[model samples]
Structure formats: C-alpha cells, structure tokens
Target: MISLHWLILSPLIIGTTAKLMPIKAAKKIMVLFQTALLAAVTMIFVEVRQNGPLLENIGSWPDTIGITLRADLLATAMVFLSCFLFLAMVIFVHNKNYADHLFFFLFLGLESLIIGIFLSNDVFNIFVLIEAATLIITILIMYKQASVSVYDGMMYFLINVVAMSFFLMGLGMLYKKIGVLDFYALEAALSQVNNPASLILPYAFMITAISLKAALMPLFSWLPKAHGTPSAPSVVSAILSGLYVKTGIYVFLRLQTTFAPLIDTSELFVILGFITAVVGFMLALAQTDIKLLLAYSTVSQIGVIMIGISLNNPAAYWGGLYHLMNHAIFKSTLFLTAGMIISEYKTRKISEIHGVYSHMPAVGVATILSILGIIGAPLFNGSISKFLIATGASGSWIESGLILINLGTIIVFMKYGQLLFGHSDKKEAANSDILEKAVVLTLSMLCFLGGIFGSDLIAILFNISLTINPLSYGEKMLLFVGSILLGLLIYRSLFKKRNPLAFIRSFELGFNEICLSITLFFAFMVVYLKITL
Candidate 1:
C-alpha cells in the first residue's frame, strides 16, 4: 500500500518549505525528513525483498496507458542507498557555514531526482529525471561560484545535455519502432523483432549516454573535475562519488537486462572495464592533490565494479553490485575525512600534509580504514568483493589482470597512507564535530565488519548464499600482503621522485574533442554490434 510517487514528491515539497524557513530550522527539518525517508525506503526494500516488485501506474491507469514505476530488489536497493547517503550527507553538513536553506533545497531536490530515476519503469521518464538532475548538479558544482571555475560547471552541464540528447534520440527510435517506452514492454517488443540489427543505433545511443554518466573511459574526463573541484563541499563530493555516479551503472545494468534476450555485450564491457581500471589508477598515481587522487581512485574502483558485472559468472555479477555498495560506503568516508583534513592542513597538496594520526585521530582512523577497504586489504570490504571477482575469473588472464590492478591500487594508497602519520605540532588537530566523528568511525567499522561477514552480507543483499573457498581465500590473503610490500617498494623507488607523468594529472579534453569522441564511440559500438550480433 506504500505509494511510490510520494517518495519523489515529498522531498520537493519539503525542500521548498525548508528553503522558506530559517536556516537553523531548515537543517533540522531536512535531517528529520531524510531520517523518515530512510525508514520508508527500508520498509519498501524489505517488502520488495519478501514479495516481489511493486508496480504502479500514474492516475490509477493501466501500465500501458500511463507513466509507470517499478521497484524490484535492485531498484529498491539503489533507492535505499540514495536515501541512506543523503541522510549521512545532511548530517555531515549540519554545522557547516554553507548549510543554508537554499543548500538544503538543492540537495534535497537532487535526492528526489535520484530516487525517481531508480523507481521509474518508463525510459522517457528516466530521460527527464536525468536531464533535470544534470541541471541541479550543474548549479551545485558551482554553488560557491567564487571558489570554483565557471568553466568547470558549464562544461559538465554542456556535456550531459549533449549526451542525454543522444539518449532522447535513442528513445525516439525505440518508441517509433515499438510504440512503447516502458522498459518491460520494449524488452518484450524487441524480443519479437525479426532482426536485432535495427536496434544497434538505439542501443548505442542509450549506452553512450549511460557510459558518459557512469564516467567510463574517454567519457571520464568530466568526473575528476566535478567531484574534486575546490568549490564542491565534501558532502556533495560524497554524494556524487558515493551515490550519484552509481545511477549510471544502475541504468547500465537495467538496460542490459532489457536487451539480454537480443544481444550480449558482456565481453566488450569486460575488456573496457579492465582498461578503465588500469588507466584510472595510472592517472591517480600522477596526482599531487589529495582530492584529485581520491577522485581518480573512484574511477579505478568503478572500473572494477563494471568488470565484475560484465562477467558471465553469476557470483561475479553479485560481487560487482556488492562492491558498488562497499565502494559507496568507504569512498564517502574518505572524502568526508579528506574535507576535514584539508580544513586542518589548509592545503590540498599531498606532499604538504602530515601527522593526521597526531592531530585528528578519529579522522585518521576513518581515512586509514577506508584506504584499507579500497586497497582490498585482507580483512576489509574491498577484499571480499575483489576475491569474489577474482574467483569468478578463476582460470582466465583476467584473474591475473585483477591481481595487477590490486597491486596498482595498493601503490596509490601507499602514498596516500603517509597522510595518516607525522607531527601535528605545526597545525592544530582537526576539531571535527562529535557527530561527524561518530558517523565516520561507524562507517569505518562497517568496512571491517563487512569483510568478516562477507558471505552473510552477500546472502542478505542478494538472497543467494555464496561460500568462499577457504584455500583460495588464504592464497589471496598472501597475495594481498605481498602486494602491499611490492607496492611500497615500487612507490619508494619510482613514485617518490617528482612525477614524470604529471601530464596525466593535467590532461583535459576540450568540448569539441569530447564531441568527436562521442561520435567515434557511437560508430565503434555500431561497428561492434554489426560484427558481433
């Protein structure tokens, strides 16, 4: 009996009312609403898990005649994630100078759009939600206009508009051919087609849009700028890195399911996933800015998730989704801690900061725990996910490649780890709020517990029990330790010097060039479909 539309509509009304209220009252109301929303989402998640998907048509009409919304386990999980992250973020910014009424409004508006995207069953509805979210995000990235470059915000906005335009074109073709825009209907319609080749262009267009939003290779240039820009608040970065970016991957998975009977591009995505993972960490190695380092690391981790999802193995598929949630938790913790660190050190340069353990022990602990999770340390959330991914690639070269990627990840963190120690005398310890410390340290604990209970967590999330082979897990633990030692050696011998590949850190593609890449990528997908399908 839970109405799905209320989930999307309540936030907008709450946000607008909050904006008209006093700032202090606004923050209080926003947090309360977020907490309530989280509870509502949790109830829905449980119901969907217990029964099945909940579907509703607007105005009490039939599914084929009106806008439709459906929340299966996957969609509910994502919606649940969005609400949880927003709740954390609202609290994270509770005492900040920037936590104004307008800020609450913009933030809440984005949450509404994200939840709508997850629940909507209509492709056209999704397109509208994405386009609207894109605009809101543009405003947010430039919220503190004086601190960030106008160019960065404008660039992000333009790129998304152009990309989503392609999505619109694809939707047009889909509807023209089938006269239906619902994902379920389209899948059924496409299944009855005489030739799947006709769908190549539409698929390419939609995939291209999702790829850009997901920040896949060549399309990833926009991500580091948007997430790492100085003007973005830590909570905003957390939401973007932790929750917003996942929407793209969610859409990718959803659309793939829609097209499963007609085509399979798992092989292409697997190859691309590995490439993105490698290229991402390489770029991370070249960064001196701490925020940029973490931002690039996000790119690398996203690639790993994509790889797991793209694989044909069932365990790997679940592993990827599980990793997606793990990455959200740990990455958000790191960014929040980084924000406090920057505030304390008064610098963004990794070389200039030190002695975090001496200063803000809570933040340092959180940072290190997140670092461990990210590097796939033996008893961390990341290790569990990576182990499953590697297990799925058991006999292939990809397993070996994953090992190398793990090493690369450790190497990045080895440099990052230095931030946790040194003298704090030069700068006063970060006086983070009690609430902030509680939230961060709690998140860090979850990272550790997630590893210890990986199998149980997996079973709970997906309703499928996957047991880890003890012998394989032990072998991977040894590899993990070896990777740390090896990574340390590589960092000291090579990366300790002035970064020779700093150009990678500074690389930026122009709007025109990105447009060309879009064209090329579209053509590439078309050619790939022609040959494969």
Candidate 2:
C-alpha cells in the first residue's frame, strides 16, 4: 500500500529537492532517483502480480469519503511501462548539453502525474492530475522558446483545458446523480439504476472530452502541431506519442466499462475508429516533416487500437492492449531515431535525409525494425496483434477496414523508407553515445522478440491462451506482400506527382472551430445514446 504512495510521490519530492542543487549534481541525482523509482515500480509490479491488487484509502475515512489508490494489474502494468520509458529517456539524454534543472523538474512532475492518473480510483483525483499533466506538457513543448512553439503550446494548453472542462462538468453530474466519485461505487450505482438513460448527458460530456484527448478524427488537429513542434525535444515528442495520449485511451476504457450497464456504444466507436485511421494515414502521407509524419502515424495507430478495443471480442481486446504496448516501444524508438537524424542532417525533410544506412547504421537499423513493426509485417509484433484483431473480426467488413488501414500505413512508410537507401557523397561521423544506441537497440530487439514469442508474451502479460493458426499465416503473408506492392505502386505513381494534399497539410482549425467541433460531438453522442439506450 505504502509502495504505491511512494511510487506516486517520490518523483515529486525528489524533483523539488533537486531544484536547489547545482546543475551538474542535480542531473546526476535526478538520474539516480529515476533508477531507484524504476526498481521500486518493478517490485510493486511483482507484488501486485503475486498478491492481487493492493488498495489503500487515505486516512481512516469510509470508502465514500476517502481517496483510493489501487494497484491492480492494469494500473501496475501502465506504471511499470511508464517508469521504464522515463528511465530510458533520461539515460538517452544524459550526455546532451541541454540539461536544465527546470526541465528535469517538469519531466519528473509529468512522471508523477502519469503514475497518479494510473493509480487513482477517485474520479476527481484523475481529473486534477490530468490537468496538471497537460500544463507540464505544454511547458515542455515550448521549452526552447521558439517563436512558433509558443503558439503551439498555447493552442495545446487552451484546447485541452476546454476539453477538460467538459470532463469536470460530467464529474459533477455523476456526483449529483450517484452521490459518489469512486469508480466502483459509480458502477454499482449505475447497475442498480432503473433508467440508465438519465446519465446520457454526462456520458456524452465525458466521452467527448476523452475523444479529443485520444485525437480521434476532427479533435486530432492539435496533435500533429504539438508533437511535431520543431523546438520540442525528441524525448518530449516520444513521451507525448508513446505515453501521454494513451492516458485518454486509459480513461476512455475505464469510463466505458463503468457505464457498460447503461449503454453499448461499441458499434459507433468502431465506425469512428475506421474514420480516424483513414484520415490519420491520409494526412500522414501529405507531411514533408519527418516528425509530423510520425505524429500523424500516432493518430492512425491510436485509431487501430480503438478499433480493436471497440470490437469487444476477447481476442481483439487483448490484441488492442498488446498493440498499445508495442506502439509505445516502437514509436518511441522511431521518434528518438528521427531526432538523431534531424540533428545530423540539420533538416526535417524526409526527402533530404538520404544514405542513413551509411551515415548512422545503428539508427538506420532501428528505424527499419520500427517500420516493420508498424507495417505489421509477418513475424513482427504488429503482425501478431493485427492477426488477433483480424481473427476476431471473423471475415467481416471490420476485417476489411483493418486491411485498408494497414495499406495506408504501408504506403506512408514506403515513402519514409526512402531515407534508408541511396548514397551520400559527404562522409559523416558515427554517433558515439552508447546510452542512446543501447536504448534504440533494446527497444528494436523487443519488437523482434515480441513477434517471435507473440503467443507466449500474451499469456504472460494477460494470462490469455491464444493459438496461432498455421493456415491463416500463409494468407496473411500473401496479403502483406500484396499490400506492400500496392503501397509502393501508389507511392511512386500517385504520391510523387504534384502535391495535391497541400490544403490538408496547411489546414489549421481556429479555437472557435475546435470548440464548435467538441460541442457537436457531445450533442451527437447524447442523441445517439438516448436512442440506443
């Protein structure tokens, strides 16, 4: 119980303490502190795995009156992943010269906020932590003080605050109707309610805000800007794509489960997920900036994950969860590698950064592995998760949608793959940072191992027994090869022509438009729930 508290608070405590120290000493202390926190989180994960969930209520107050922190399997798994990623990121940046005390302070604070969001069972606590995390991320985005970054940071901050206000309104509604802010209590009360439709407005309000956070469709306009800001650090971009956005998915999962008795919106989510995937990859194809391409790719992958979860099949749910983990690993590797590439070439344009294999073989190799993982090639982690999702679809249109999404992914990455080849006349020195190389190698290796032992890995993480179909393997391979060929053909014949997607690439929605979109989404959700429930 106390272990959970320490995991959440220790970072905040240490970060504040380190602020008073000299820069060099503070950097060392911060790294050491992160290492210790990682070990502590690992131990807590083991305890939770062995002893079931560990729940603690602040003070001696009754369950309804006290704050609850629960270390269940899902929460522990997220915390463990967060800690591992943060540690890797810290190590990756350790030797860089931009080690500012305030930067580390905000970084650690973001870690604490994420852990708190995962552990807290109280609705209000999660809300507050999420808001704080948003502020920290905004500051981190604008840390370099680049002119355009200020606008990007302000857009991210203001838009998210508006979205969260809806969450607060929904929270108030829940308290008014149920007289409790606890997840378990709300679920119990909802189950007992005679007319669940009465909660439709609250549900709409909350889910609307969550959809924005998840960057689904129209709400996703802000994601590429924030994640691809030229001034933000690569680690910041990695954290945003790899972990922060998933907080919305986490909350979405929790809220949907809590309201399961009241409504079943899985089909609607399935349609929306498909839309998001298509829109995301299409936009990704239009990007010249490498980071923006990755940012839009995150949007597309989030849609894929959403599709898997909304399908509501056991295998698909497990696949979605596995994909969530895989995305974090491979996407982080890709972003970090992209950062190195940008640094070496002094450019973000994908077309300009050729001969990576000759210039930086390690990063180049890692980038290829990540691309394979994202493209769902056979014997990659993405393939296994995608296989599970497709199998669960049982040859329906949903499976077809998955294939189309994969095709789009392959097409965009096929363009990106250009950087891996071609010759450069100028010679460049190889990166000598062992820590950075090790991080990329480790994550890339995990991508391969995860695919090789996909079933066993699933059983270990989720305790679900899934068998691979040998017959399906041949068909999947055939489809994958066909998609690759088609993607290459499409890229060469269509994408290389006059840039027709310039409008989408340059489009920006004003704050008023974003608010209008949110309102429309909420109203749509309310009407849909009213009719369905």
Candidate 3:
C-alpha cells in the first residue's frame, strides 16, 4: 500500500513541478500525474478494505506528540473519492477554455488539502487544512477576475473566515481541557472526565462552524453565490458541488464520533436537516437561472444526507453515507453537463434553453440519467439510499417528512428538466470535446451502476452486507412512483402559473444575517445540551 503521507503530498509535488514546465508539456505531465495518483489511491483503498486501517505517527515521535495520519475506512474512502473526482475534473477541463497550468496547480493543491483534512488525526491540523482550502477556493472562484466574480469570491472567503474562527475557538477549548489535539488521544482523555457538560460549549462552537461548512440552513447563503458564479468554470463548479462541500459533512461526522461519549445532538441535526431540505428546495423551485437552481438543489441534498446520518438508526446512517457518495457522482454529472448546456445555448435561464436532446444527444442522455439518480427513481443510486433511509423512518411522522422531501426534490428537478426537450434546427457538431463528454457520461453511468450494486457497494465500503427485502423494495417502488406523479401535478398547478415560488427566488441571507444565525444556532445547541445533560 502507498504511504498516507505520499497520498497527501504527491498531488502538491506534481502541481509545483508542472508549473516549472512548458504549458504544453505541463498538460501532458498533469495527465500522467493524475493517472498515477488515482492508481495509488485505488491501491490504498483496496488495501484498507482487505486489511484494516493503516495508522502512522509522523516525525518518528510518540503517538501522543506526533502528527498521526490515519487511513481508516472513512478516511481512505474519502481520499479515494476525492482522488477520483479530481481526476475527472482535470479530464473535464482538458482542451476546455479554463485548462491552464495555474488552474491545475490550484486544483491539485486543493486536492492535497482535502486529503490532509481526511487523513488528519489532530483537530488543529484539520483547522489549518480547512483554512488553506478556503483560500485556494477563494482564488478559484475569483479565477475569472471579473468584477462580480471577485465579489463572490470575497464573500465566500469572508464568510468562511468567520466560521473557521468558531472552529479554532472550539479546538482551543478542547486542547486546554484535555491537553490533546489528536482524536484518539482526546477521546481517551475525555473518557476520564466525570461530567460531559464541560464539552457542551466546545461542541456547540465546533458544530456551528461545521454546520456552516456543510451549508446547513442559515449558513447556506454562500453556496449558491460560489457554486453559481457566472464566470466560474464547469470543472470548478463540479468540484465545489460534488467534492468540497462533502468535506464539511465528513468533518461533521468525525466530530460527532469524537464527542459520542459526551453528546447526542442527532435530534437537533435531524430537525435542522428537515428544515434545510424544505427551504433549500423551495428556493431551488423559485430560481430561473439554471446554475443557481442546481446550487440550491445541492443545499437540499445536503439536508437529506444529514437526516440519514442523524436518524439514530443503522439503516439510515449507512444510507446517508452511501447517499453522500451517490451525490458526488450524480451531482457532478449534472454540473458538468449544465456547463456544457449553458455554453451551447448561450444562456443560463431555464426558460431560454431548449432542444437539448436535438442539439446534443449525448449530453441530453447524461442529464436524464443524472436527474433520475438525484430524484430517487427506482433502479438508481438515490433510490437505494433513500429506500434505506425510509426503511429506518418507517411507521413514524418522520417517514412522511422523508416522503415530502423526496417529492420536493422531484418537483425542483421537474422544473430544471425543461432543458431536455423542444425544437432546434442547429446541428449537433462542436458539442464540447470528446474527453469532457466522456467524463460526464462516465459519472452518469456510475449513477446507474451504483444502484444495481448498491448492497455490494455498501459491503465493500462499510465492511457490512445488507440485503434489500424484495417485498419492501416493491413498496418503495410504489412510493417512488406516487411521489413522481404528485410532484408533477404540483409542479403544473402551482409552479407553471404566474409562478407561485417566484418571489422566494429573491430571498437571500446577507452576511450579517448569516453571522447572527450562527450565534443563535450555537446558543441553541449549548442550551439544549445544558438542559438535557
């Protein structure tokens, strides 16, 4: 197996070296490096799956003092996913307008940072990695250097800096109290404490920042602006939507596990998840700009993932993790295709774009598969995960809520799906490069294959096998159909009219409002723990 240190360092090394080469040669070098990196990541993933976690403390120091790099199942899986997606993003940008040495350099640098975050055992190290990632992402968003792009990039940067301050404060509290920054060391230290109450404020502080990073509820205002920046390239949007946002949720899971003995905030996140999901889709429904619509949809999907994770059920939790992977595939496909569609049609408006199938059949097909995957259509990746989540929520009011969320997802996509049909006389040639098309279609195909082998994938990823009950699967299939019909009816009656959801489109949280919400959220978490514990 490859060393975890190299897994985190190789990308940065290649990126720096590529900068010194000729632009033409750099592109070729990038291809070789990406191929080698992905192969190394795959081997590490296979080794971890076959054996167990690979743990090392760097600098040859004692475990408690050294920087520990842990390649557990979760960390390795995330590394593999990040590597795969980064490779795809690189390929998607090949021969495209934004395929420059500097872009690839920043892109690979971000990959290294993300890998570091995944493998880090020290909470402080995670904080540092996230800070570096935020800066790189800011530069990426502002890559166009246009007036609006700069403003969006700065807005994203300012908001994240505020959030990271909360994280740093929490880390300081934990270290001061436990005298340990490493997760294993801290967990051991925390167990000796008599009162779990001491960690409440720290949990509140840290989770508040992580929730913001996950784009949860009131903190989600930055997502649309960053992801839908008019000047941002499709590859950038794909990585932001498909990969970067997930790091927040991944960190969220890590912190929750670390504090498992002290706190059980699943209920709070479940409530927040539902609200975020509902509100997110409502905003998506109101949007006319196609990229903004997809960005808002991402907010809604994150909410669904949170619900799956926090439901306090094994089925739901695994489903959430599985859905997280599925989202990376299908959503990346959508953003990549959306970029192509916008380029070909010369507009981002949902109403203005038409004849997608006639204009570009391959892209149109990919979009259809991706939409199917996202909406949880039967025999797709989303259905399997949502089914597992529904199985966990069965016979409860929460089940109805899950159904409603599914319906909302369908309705929003129904609005977005208008791009696939209508008339066009233009010929289909010059439809993006073949390589870009291949990347999008490959992700689209994964959306299909992932479902067909959902249970097997879970077994491989989680080291646990689950068999989907045939009878229950049939029932879920019915619910899926029913939700589709209901979503379509609602879309026509309410959405197609003078557009009932149109006004909510303009609703956006300002910087001040987002900051206030963060404080309130933290207060709520602390107070809730104070009373309950």
TM-scores for candidates 1 onward, in order: 0.98, 0.97, 0.98
| Model 2 regions lying over 4 Å from their true place | 430-432
| Clash totals for all candidate models | 0, 0, 0
lDDT of each: 0.88, 0.88, 0.89
Instruction: Give candidates' CA RMSD values in order.
Output: 1.3, 1.5, 1.2
Tens-place lDDT digits, model 2, residues 1-533: 34577888898888889889987788788879888888887787778878888888878678977989988888888888898899889888888776577888899999999999999998899999999999999999999899888889999999999999999999999899999989888889899988878899888988999999999977898898799999899999999999989888988999999999878899999889889999999999989999999999999999999999999898888888889888998899999999988888889998888888788889889999999999999999999998888888876899999999999999889888888889864475865488888888888878888899999988866657999898997799899999999888888888866456757876778888899999989989988987888
Per-residue lDDT tens digits for candidate 1, residues 1-533, read: 46999899889899999877888888888889999998998898889889999998999877766999998988988888788888888888889998788888889999999999999999999999999999898888888885464677888899889899999998899888889988888888878988889889999999998998998887888888888888688888888898899999999998998988888999999988898899999999999998899888999999999999999998788889999999999999999998888988889988888888778889988998998899988889999999999989989988999999989999898888888777665654467898788888988888999899999988877777898899999999999888888988889898887676687855678899888888788889999999999
TM-score (C-alpha, index-matched) for candidate 3: 0.98
Off by over 4 Å in 3: 425-430
- Write down the worst ten-residue block by lDDT for model 1: 422-431
lDDT of 1 at 243: 85
Model 1 residue 487 CA deviation (Å) reads 0.7
Off by over 4 Å in 1: 425-427
> How many times do residue backbones clash in model 1?
0
Best by lDDT: 3
| lDDT for position 476 in model 1 | 96
lDDT by residue for model 3 over 450-526, one digit each (tens)? 99999999898888777899899999899889999899899899986557888886667788887888888888888
Candidate 3 residue 70 Cα shift, in angstroms, is: 0.5
For model 1, state the Cα shift of residue 400 in Å: 0.9
